[model samples]
Target: MDKKVTIYDLAKELNVSPATISRALNDHPSISLNTKKRIVSYAQRSGYRINKFAANLSKQKSNTIGVIVPKLNSYFMSSVLSGIEKVANGHNYNLIISQSLESENKEKLNTQTLYDSGVDALMVSLAFGTENYDHFALFRDQKIPLLFFDRVCHLPNCPTITIDNRKAGADATEHLIQNGCKNILHVGGHLKRNVYTDRFTGFKDALNKYGLEYKPSNFIETNLDAAKIEEIIDHLINSKEKFDGIFFANDAMAVACMQSLLKKGYRIPEDIKIIGFNNNPISEIIQPNLSTINYPGYELGVLAGQSIISHLNGNINIESAESILLKHELIARASSSSTN
Candidate 1:
């Protein structure tokens, strides 16, 4: 391999001391602007790379923010990650992202690895089965800024960003009722998760407000797997009281449900109306466009990035801010609208 360019090489080439090169590269105020510019240009042209590990160890700052998510393949989660990368890169920070694959054990391991890697901050969206958050204590004990978005858990001093799930859920159910859907079924994810649980609470609250009877058969909890769509279809087909509407926790499940319903000769919004959360792109692509709550995953990520960076810069006291709730809106489409 060719000889790797180093600070010493650049210093020798520029006829400056190694200390001067180091200071200039770091953008120290003591170095003259002209000298710093020259050093930077030369370093760039020479393909010089700084050993960030050594520098991070010496300065005790990694300039890297760690992010943990349940999965990377989802449209909404990936969009959120893209937004985070945009803000972090603009601010000269790097993101180290890892997936938990909905496994709490893997999530714990990733948390420990991120901490060991000396990430300056941590952002997490909990795994599906992550009931225990003890792995996050290392960061808390060390006083590193930790932020949670979407699938969040309340850890003392950690800032969390999410929409008012209860309100959104209520809105979705109420919309269905307004469109003359009395016998509605809510397909949901794990109830252990606050997002789904809060949504289910809203679902019940709306039913109670409208004086509609809450039936045990009205709520179907699943992992939202597409493969299990047949089971839901079977339930819908065999139900004594036909469900006129459906409210799903996530767009993926809603889309799967819609497809299954269509195959069974149910006309969307004509026979049954449907609404889902997280205005994912698929919501638009489906035959009868799905009406959904616009969850704004990208904006959530940007806000999370800004909040953590602000905390790191000492410009904002994150501890004083307990929860940051983003606005959610109901998007009317062919699936849930009567007149559309």
Candidate 2:
């Protein structure tokens, strides 16, 4: 086996002290820019990788942030991850991203693993099944920076990043009402999640503003699994009550139900106008483009990265930091167009 290169080897070859080589490689201000470039160039050519584990031991920091999301396959989650990676990389921080797969136990396990691995900070978008947040107590007790986005919960001194879901939800519902939808149906995910519950609340807010009675029969709460589109379609198709509009909690399920309804000879925006949340890429690709709430998932991720990094660097006190709420917009499309 070939021997791996180290800082001592670089210092021996470069005729400098190990401390000087370390400072140069780390781009310390005391090191000249020319020295830094020369050391960095030589280190790259010699395949001298930084020993992060040893470095973290000295600094008492992993230089790695832990992130937990419900699922990784969705466009919104992917976009958020991309943004987080971009920021984390620019700051010389690595991300340990894990998906809970919507299971509370899995989320708890991931939390424990990241904590055991000594992550500098933790960021989470809570899972649908996460009813209890006791798993995060270790981080809080240790004064580790913890931030939440998207599907968030109330935890003491933990800053959060998210759009105003309730307002966005109200905007989506109001758009439908303005377009002449009198009897509207709302399809949401698990109410345990703030994202789904807040959006549902917004839906009702709009309904009440226009004097439309809230009907329990008009609401459907599920896991929002696209594979189970049959259940949603069956309810919509066989409902005894009439519905002229629908507000879906997510773009994937909305697109799935829209396609299934189209196959059943339902004309979108003509027979039933629809609006979904998230504004995912598939929203535009659907036959009739889906009207949706622009949740800005990527922006949320970027802000989350910046906030946590700032806390870790002591530039901002996480203990005193307030939760960040990003702006959201309502997008109108063919799916919710008014026939009039």
Best-matching candidate per TM-score: 1
Report clash pairs, candidate 2: none
Error of 1 at 23 (Å): 1.6
Q: State each candidate's clash count.
A: 0, 0
lDDT minimum window of 10 residues, candidate 2: 1-10
Which residue runs of candidate 1 sit more than 4 Å off their true CA positions? 9-17, 32-47
Model 1 lDDT tens row, 113-195? 99999999999999889989899999999999999998888889999999999999999999999898999999988888889
Candidate 1 to native Cα RMSD, angstroms? 2.2
Candidate 1's C-alpha lDDT? 0.91
The lDDT leader among the candidates is: 2
Cα lDDT of all candidates, in order? 0.91, 0.92
* Per-candidate TM-score against the hidden true structure: 0.93, 0.90
Model 1 clashing residue pairs (backbone): none
